[model samples]
Target chain A: MSAGALPPRVRIVEVGPRDGLQNECVALGIDDRLTLIDRLADAGLRDIEAGAFVSPKRVPNMAGSGELMQRLPRRAGVSYPCLVPNDTGLDAALAAGCTDIALFAAVSETFSQRNTACSIAESMDRLSAVARRALDAGVRVRGYLSCVIGCPYEGAVESRKVADMAARLIDMGCYEVSLGDTTGIGTPAQIAALIDTVAAQVAVTRLAGHFHDTWGMGAANVWAALQRGVTVFDASVGGLGGCPFAPGASGNVATEDLVYMLDGAGIETGIDLRALVDTARWISARLDRAPASRVARAFPPTPER
Target chain B: MSAGALPPRVRIVEVGPRDGLQNECVALGIDDRLTLIDRLADAGLRDIEAGAFVSPKRVPNMAGSGELMQRLPRRAGVSYPCLVPNDTGLDAALAAGCTDIALFAAVSETFSQRNTACSIAESMDRLSAVARRALDAGVRVRGYLSCVIGCPYEGAVESRKVADMAARLIDMGCYEVSLGDTTGIGTPAQIAALIDTVAAQVAVTRLAGHFHDTWGMGAANVWAALQRGVTVFDASVGGLGGCPFAPGASGNVATEDLVYMLDGAGIETGIDLRALVDTARWISARLDRAPASRVARAFPPTPER
Candidate 1:
C-alpha cells in the first residue's frame, strides 16, 4: 500500500466539457464550452473529452457539439475526443474532423436500453459498426462501459457481463476501455472485484476508472482501481454533472480533487493544482453554481469574499 | 484488496458533537446537542464525543457540557466521552459524573502551541497528568493526536513524531489513540506510510483514523488505514466541522459517508445508513447549512424538495 504500488504517472481523461456539461441543467454556448476546454488544456490536461455528437433534440446541453469539436484548439500533445453513439453520430464526428472518438456501452440491460434506446446486445452491435467505421477513417477509438458496478435501473451488475462487454469493445478496435460506475453507488471492494474480473479479459494497462462522487466513495474507488493497476481516470472540472435519477448527487469525480490526491501521493500527473483550481472556479462561475470539488472549496477565499 | 482483506467490523467514534460543532459559527443549546447525540445513538453509534469540558469563553458552543453530560440518557451500550484538555477540564468532567474522557495533543510544535497554548512536550505532560487522574477514577481515557499528517502552521509533520506521541499516549494509559489530519492535507500514500510507521510502535487495533475532508482525501485515507489493519475511525455526522483557517473547507469526514462506504463493502458498522443520513440532515438543518456529505445529498429528495 505504498506509493510504489501505484503507477508512477497517471493520465487523467478530462470529461468536463462533454459528460459533465451534458448532464447539467444549464446549457453553455459553444464559445463558453471552448473557453472551458482551453482552460483545462492550459491546466495541463492532455486528454479532454470535447463534446458528444448525439442529437441536439434529446440533449439540448450538447446542441453545438459538432461545432465545438471543429472549433477546439488543437494544441500539441493534447487530444480532444468526442463521444459518438451510433453511425450517425460517428458520421457527425467524422464530418467535424474528429481524430479521436469514444464509443460507449452499458453492462446492464435496463440501463443500456434506457440510456441508448437499445438492449445491451443491440447497443454493442451498433457500437461495433461505429467503431469499425471510425477506425477505418483512421480515428483512434476509446470505449466507455457504463454501469460496470451498479445501475440505477438494475441494482447490481455482474462483473462477468462488464468484462464480456469490455472484451468485445477491445476486439472492436478500442485501444482502451473505461469502466464507469454510472450510479456512483460502487464501494472500493466492489471496484476492486470488478477490476480484478475485467483485467483478466482486458490488459490492466488498457483500463481506466470513471467514478462519480454521489455517495462520497469516488476517491476510495479510484484508489482501489489504482491499486489494481488502472492508471487512467475520468474526472470533470468543478465536479460537474448531477445524477438525473438522484437529484443533488455529484457525477464525475472533480479533476482538482483527483489532482490534489495524486500530487500529494507523489504521483506525477503533469497537471498544475493551482491552475486547475482556478479553472474549476472560472467554469463553475459560468455555470452559475459553486464548484462541487472539496479542493476547490478549500482554496484560498476569493477577494470578493 | 478484497473485502476479506479489510477488518470484518469497524468501530466508529462519532466526534460530531465535540470536534464537529466546536468550529461552527452557530451555537446550539444543550437540548439540541442532546437531541443530536440521542439521534446518533438511535442510528447505532455507540461511541460519541458528547462535548468538550473547555472554557466557555474560548468555545462558547460547549458551555453547558457538564450539565449536558448529567442529562444524557444512560443507554445500555452507548458511551459518551467528553474532551478534557487539562486538569481543570478533567475535574469538571469528573464532577459531571463522566465515566469516559478524551485527551488531545498535536504532533507539530507550532500547532501544539497555537491550538493548546503550549508546546508538544508541555501538552503531553499536562495530558499525562489528566490521563492518570482519569484512569485512577475508574474512567476510560482515549487520546487524540492532531496534525498527524499535516499542520496548517508547520506544513508537513513527520510520521516519526506522530508515532512517538502516539506511543507516549498509549503508555500513559489510553485504550486507543486517534490520529487526526487536522489540516485535511494527507493523501493515501502518506497515510499508508504513517500507519506503517506508527503501527510498528503501537498495535494497529488500538489506532484510529480521524480524517478531515478538506481536500476530498478522507475516504481514500480511511481506506489506506483500513488496509493497514486500523479498524476504528472518528467521523462527524454531517461533516460538521470546518477548518477555521481554510475558509469553506470541510473538517471531519461525514459519518454517513463512511457508513455508506463500509456498508457497501460488506463491512459491518452496526449503523443504519438511512437513519444516519436522517440524523445528518436533521443536524445540518439545525445548523442552517447543507449536509456536507455526498451520501446525504444523494438520498431520496426530501418531501419539501
Candidate 2:
C-alpha cells in the first residue's frame, strides 16, 4: 500500500451507550446514560449508538433506552442510533422517535445459536423484517455482523462467509455493515484478509470495523482496516462492555485511545480527545472502576501549568 | 506495498528481565530473575535481555544482574544480553562472563539529562569507550536509542536527530540499533516517518522497534514498522516495567501479546505462546498484580474438557 493511501478523515460510531453499557455489572441510571450520550455529542461524535430496544429481561442495563432516546437533546448534526433486535424492538425505537436503527446477526452458526438462540439463517430472516420496517419508516439502518473474524465456540471463521453475510445485509437494505470481532480475537493479517474478502462483495466504503480489545489487538486491527480503506469505526467510551458470551474477554476498543492514535496520525476525526477522556473518567468513576482507555490514563488532563 | 512484503520471520529481543524489573515496585530476588530468563529461554526466545549492570543505588531491582548472569545456565542457542550503561557496567558484565551487551542513549537532550544524568554527547562518548572495550573482548554490542519518537520531558523529537543518533551508534560498532519509544507516545504515522528517516542512514534490517504500550499504540506502531521492512523488535514479558519518568504509563509491549500478533500474522517467531502465557501468569502472580498481557488473560490455559 502507498503510504499516502490512508484516509484523510474517518467517521467514528460511538457504541458505548449500547454495546459498552449492556454488559456492565452495575446499571447506569437513565440520567447517567443521557449524560454519556450528551458528553459524546459534545465531544464532536456525529454518530452515537445511544442504546438498544431489546427486552430488559435479556439486557437489563439497557432497560430504559427508549426513555433515554426520548430525553436525549437533539443536536444539529449528530445522529443517535438505537439497536433493534426484532420487530418489537424496532416498534419501541419508532415510538421513542429514533430516526436511525441497527440490527445485528452473527456470521458463524455457533455464535448465532449461542448468542441469539437461532441459526444464522434464522437470525438473518428475523433481522430482514426489522430492516424492511425501519427502511419503510425512513430510518437509517446499520447492520452488525458479529463473529466476523472468529467465534468462541467455532474457532476460526471463513472470510468468504463473512463477506457473503455482509453482502446479504447490504442487499437487505442496511446502509452500512459493521463487521464485529465480538470475541476480540482478530489479528492484522486476519483483518486484512477479512476486509479484502468483504470488500470484494460489499463496497469498502459501506463497511465499518468494530473490534474489541480483549487481546489488545483493537488498535492494530483498526490500523489494518484503515490500510484497506475502511473509514468508519465503532468504539466505546471508557472501553466499557465485555461480551457476556465470551467470558474473560475485555471491552470494546476505547474511543479515547482510538482518537489519540488517529489525532497523532494527522487524520481528521473532529473529536476532542480531552473531552472524551473526561467523559471516560467520569463514567469509569461512577462505575467504580478505572477507565480502560490507556491514553486516558497516560495523558490525563493536566491542570493549566 | 504488496501483501507479501511482510517479512517471513522476525526476531524478538525479550527485555522483561532487564528493562522490565528495573522499574518494578518490588525487587524480584536473584532466583526470580534467573527463573524469568530460564522460562523465556524455554519459551523459545533465543535473544533475551537477562539483566543490567547499572548502579544498584540507582536501580536496586537490577542489583544482582552480574551474579544472575554468571549463574545463568548456558543454553545451546540462546543468547542473554545485559544492559551496560558505561565502562564500569561493561567491566562488571565481563567479570561475570557475559558476551552480549546493550548500551542505551536518548535522542533528546532532556531525556539524556534526566535518565542518564549526562548530555547526549557525553553519554555517547562514555558508551563509545564501553563499546570499544567490549568489542575488544569479543562481545556483541547493541545500541538503544531512547525517545526516538517523543520524550517525556522534551515532547516531540525530530526524526532526523534520531536517525543521526542511530547512524552514530552503528558507526561505533553496534551490530544493531533499537529505536525506543520510551514514553510510548508514538503513532503509526510517526513510526513510519521515523523508520523511513532512519532507514535513509542505516539499513532497515539493522534497526529494531522497541515500543512501550503506555498509550496502547505499541502493536499498531509495530505494524507500521513491519510494513516498512523492520523485522526485529523488543518486548517485555507480562508487559512489565512502567516508565519512572512518565507517570501512569504502561510497560513495554508484552512479549506474549507481540508473539500472538506475529504468529496470527503468519510471521515465524519460533516462540511457544502457551508457554509464554504461563510464564507471564506465573510472574504476575508473584508480583501480586494481574498480567498486563491481554492475551494471557483472555486465553488462560484450560484443562481438557
Candidate 3:
C-alpha cells in the first residue's frame, strides 16, 4: 500500500451476526441475536450477514434467524445478506426479505461430497438454480468458493481449478465471487499466484477474499489478494465460525483485525472497531469462549481500567 | 513442506515467559508462572522464556522473573531465556541460573529513542556490554532487532537498515539475532527480499523470525523467512506481547498457531499443540483476555468440547 495513495473505498461484509454465530452450539436467545445485529449496524457496518436459514434441526443455534431478521431495525441502505444452501434455505432467506443471498461451494470434490452431500457439479447446479431464482426475484447473488488453496480431505487445490470454479459461478449469475482459503494453508506467493490465475478469467472488481486462520495466514492471504485488486472481504466478528469440515480449521479473518488493517492502510471500511470489540465480547460470552479476533484482544488497556 | 522430503525444522523461541508477559499490568503468582512454563515444556517446547528481570517499579509484571527463574521446573535439555535489558537484569537472570539472556534493539532509530529512551547506537552499546558480560559468564546472548519492517514513529522500515542492525547485533557476540516486524507492516515479498539482502552479510542460520500479527500476516511472514532457509522463529504463547512503542499493535504470532503451521506443513517445531492450548487458556484467563492463537480455537470440538 503506498503511503499517500488514495485509500480504497470498499464494502466490508460483517459475517459475525450470521456465520459467526450460526455454527456455535451455544443457544443465544433471539433477543441477543437481534442486539448483535443492531449493535453491528450501529458500528457502521453497511453489510451485515444477518443469519443463515439452514434447518434448525441441523443448526439449532441459527433456529430463529427468520424471527431475528423480522425484528431488525429498519435502517435504509444497510444491506443484509443471508446464506442459502438449498431451496429451503432460499425460501427461508426470501421470507426474511433478504435482498442479497450467498451460495457456497467447495473447491475440492471430496469436500463438496462431505460438506454438502453432493458432487461439485451437482452443488454448482443447485447454486445456479438458486442464483437464477434469486435473480428473477430481484435479488443479487454472491458465490463463495471454499478451500480454494487446500482442503483437509483432498489437499492442494490447483489454482486453475479454483479459477474455473469461480468463472463458472460468475456465469451462473453471481455478481461477485469470493475465493476462500478455507484451511488457511496458503503462502503469500502461492496465494498471489492463485489470484493472478483467477483474475485472468474474472474481473478483479467481482472478487472478494475470504480466509480462515487455521494455519494463521488468513490476513496475509487477504493482503495478497488485495494487492491483486480484490476490494471486498468476508470477516467474522470476533473471528468466529471455524470449518466443521476441516477439523483443525479456525475462524475466518477477524472483522476487527480486517478493520484495523484497512484503517492503517488508509482504506475506508466504515466500521467502528471499538463497537466490534463490544460485540465480540458479548458473543464470546454467550458462547463461553475467547474471541478469535486479535484486535479485540489488542484493545487499549483500561485506564484505572 | 514436502511430505517425503525432510521437513524443515523451525526453532521457535518461546518468549511468553519474558517478553510476552513483561508488559502486562496483571500480577501472576509464582505458582501460575511455574505451572505455565511446565505446561509449555510438557508441550514439547525446549525453549521457554521464564521471565524478565526488569525493575519492579518500572515493569511490575516482570518483577518476579528473577524469583520465577529460580523455581523453574528442573527439565533436562531446556533453555530458559530471560530478558536482560541491562547489567541489573543480567545479574538477576544469571544468579537465577539462566544460561540464555536476550537484549533488545530497533531497526528504526525513532523507535529506539522512544522504546529504550536512548538512541539506536546507545541501545546497541548497552546490548554489546550485556553480551560481553554474559559471554564472560558462560551465558549465551540472544539479540533482538525490533521494528524491522515498520515503526510507530517511523512509518516504514528499510530492509537494508534492518540488515545493518542485525549484523551489528551478531558482531556484538549475540548467538542469534531475531528480527521483529514491530509494526506488522511486512508482506511476504518484502520479507523474502529483506531475508535475501540480510543473508548476503550474515549467516542465515544465526537469524530468527519474529513477527507481530497486528496486520494478520505474522505467520505468512514466518513462512516467507522459512522458504529462504532461515529456521529460527520467536513466538509467544497465546500470541502475547506487542510493541509498546507501536500502540495497538497485535502480539507476536501465537506459539500454538506457529506450531500448527509447521506441523501441518510436515515441519518439526517440537511443540505440542494441545499442551500449548492449555497454557494459552490459562494465561489468557489470567489477563482476562482471549488467546491470540488461531489453532487453539481451531482445535477439534472436544467431547467436553
Candidate 4:
C-alpha cells in the first residue's frame, strides 16, 4: 500500500500503566499509577490500560491494581481496560468495577507454556471461558496475541498460527485483537505479512499493532501496519518497561513518538504532543531513569517548549 | 506501493567516522578513528566516509582527518569519501591523496548562514567551485543537502528548495545526492512528500536517504523512502553524533538498526549484523557511553549471541 493509504485517524491504547510498569525495575505505588492514568487522560487519551489482575506474587508491580481501580475517577468517554488472564483475574477486575477488560494468549507454544503454564490450545480454552463471562457481564473484552512475529524461545512463529489464534479470539467475543511483536524482533516486511495473514481471518478494522522498540523497528512496523488499515496501536508513556526475556531491550514504542509521527502525517490522534511529552518525563523521573523515547530525549522536559 | 515493490538491494554509505564523529562530544585520535573505519569496512560496508577536511578550530573532532585519510587502508572495492567544505578543504583532501570527496549545502537559508557563514546561493557557489576543482583532479564528488525535511533556525523548509539544491549538485558533477534530515524532525509522510518532490528534479536512482533518529522516526522515514524507490542510505555505526543545535537530540540513524531492518525485510545490504553490532559496542566503549542503537542495546556485545 502507498503512504496515502494510511488510516486517517488512529486510536492509541495507552499501555503504560499495565504492560509498561509490569516490566519496570521500580514499581510505582497506587497513587502514582492513578496520577499517571489521570495525566494520560488529561493529555486526551481515551483508552488506557490501568493494570493487570495477575497474581501479586508473580507481578509485584501490579499488586494494588484492584485498589487503584476502585479509587480511579470515572471520566466520561475514557475507558480503563484492566488485563484479566483467567476467571480469578476477571473476578478481581469485576470487583474493581472495570467495564473493559483484556485477555492475552501467546501464539508460540513455548511462550504459551512458559508465560501461562499451558499449551496454546489450553490457554485459548481458558481465555474463551473468561471472554464469555466478561461479555455476559456487559464488559467489553479485547484480545492480545503475543509472539505474532517471532518468539525468543521458538525463533520463528508461523503467520498461519497467529491468524488461527486471532480468529479464535474474535470468535470468543473479543471486540478487537492486538497483535504483539513480543520480542520486538519483527521488521516492516514481517509486520506487513503478519497483518495481511491475520487480517484475512479477522477484519482489519478490528486489529491493533502492539510493537516493541527492541531493535528500533517499532515505529516502522507500526507504519507498515497502518498502511494495511490497522487503526489502533498500543504504546507506553515513556517507553517504560524492558523485555523480561531480553534484558536492556526496549519495551513498547513510546506514545509520544507515535503521536509525533501520526500528527506529522496529518493523521488525527487527538493527543496533545507537548502534554504527552511532559507525562513521559514525569513518569520517567519517578522511575529514576531517562525516558527511552528518542522524542523525549530530543525535547527535554525542563523549561518546556 | 506494496512491500513487494521494495528494492531488491540497497547501497549503504557508512558515515560514522565523518558525520557521526563530528558531532560527538568525545574526539578520537587518528589511530582510534582508523581502527573504527577498519572495523566498519570489515563488517562489509563499502562506502565508508572517512572524515572531513574542515577548519580544526571549527570542528576539533576532525582535526587529524588529513592524516587519517592518508592512512586509511585501501581494501579492494572499498571507497573512503571525505567531506570537503570549500577550496581550502579541497586542497587539504587533495594533499592527503583522497580520490573520493563529498560537498554539503543546506536547503534552509538560515541554517546555511549559521552553519557555513554564507547564504544558500553563496554556499552553493562555494560548493560548485569545490566540486569543479575536485572533478578536474579526477576525484568523485558526492553531494549532501541538509535540512531537507525541516530546519532548526527555519521551521519548515520548502521541498522545492531542497529539490533545486539537489539538482544543482547533480549538475555540478556530483554522482549522488544525499538528502539529510539535519534536525531529525521529519515524519514518514513528510519524508515521502520530500522524496516525491525531489525525485521529480533528480533521478530517484541518484538519490540517497540520510536520516537522524531524533524523534525515533528515522527507521520509519527510511521505510517511506524505500517505498519511493530510493535505495542508497547514509547511516552511522552505533548511531554516533548528536544534533549540535539540539543539545540532547540524536543524530544519524544507526547502521546496525538500518542493516537489521533491511536484512529482515529480505533486502540485501551486504553487511553482517553481528559484526556491525560488535563494532558498535567497540566504538561505544571507546566513547564511554552505551551505543545509541536499540539493536546494539537489545543484543549486547556480550558472550556472542
Model 4 misplacement above 4 A: A243-246, A300-305, B243-247, B300-305
TM-score of 1: 0.97
Q: Model 1, which residues run further than 4 Å from truth?
A: A243-246, A301-305, B243-246, B301-305
lDDT for each residue of candidate 2 in A1-305, tens digit (9 for 90 to 100): 65578888999999998899987787999999998899999999999999999989988999998888899889989999999989999999999999999999998897888878999889999989888989999999999999988887888999999999999999999999999999889999889988999999999999999999999999999998999989999999989986434556678999988998899888999999988988898898888877777887887675754
Whole-model lDDT, model 4:
0.92
Model 1 per-residue lDDT at B144: 92
Per-candidate DockQ vs. reference: 0.73, 0.71, 0.23, 0.79
TM-score of each: 0.97, 0.97, 0.71, 0.98
lDDT of 3 by residue, B51-140 (tens): 878778877777787778888867899998888889978888888998988888888888878877899888888888889999999998
Tens digit of per-residue lDDT, candidate 4, span B14-44: 9999999998888899999999999999999
Question: Across residues A1-305, which tens digit of lDDT does each residue of candidate 1 receive?
Answer: 55677789999999999999998878899999999999999999999999998889998899988888888879989999999999889889999989999999988888888889999889988889989999999999999999898888878889998898899999999999999998898999889989999999999999999999888998999988999999999999989896344455677999988998888788999999888999899988887887888899887754652
lDDT of 2: 0.90
Provide the overall lDDT of each model, using Cα atoms, as 2-decimal numbers: 0.90, 0.90, 0.78, 0.92
User: What TM-score would candidate 4 get against the native?
Assistant: 0.98
Error of 4 at B179 (Å): 0.3
Put down candidate 4 lDDT per residue, A110-139, tens digits, no spaces: 999999999999999999999999999999
Q: Please state the Cα-based DockQ of model 4 relative to the true two-chain complex.
A: 0.79
**Pairs of residues at least 3 apart in sequence or in different chains that clash in candidate 4:** none
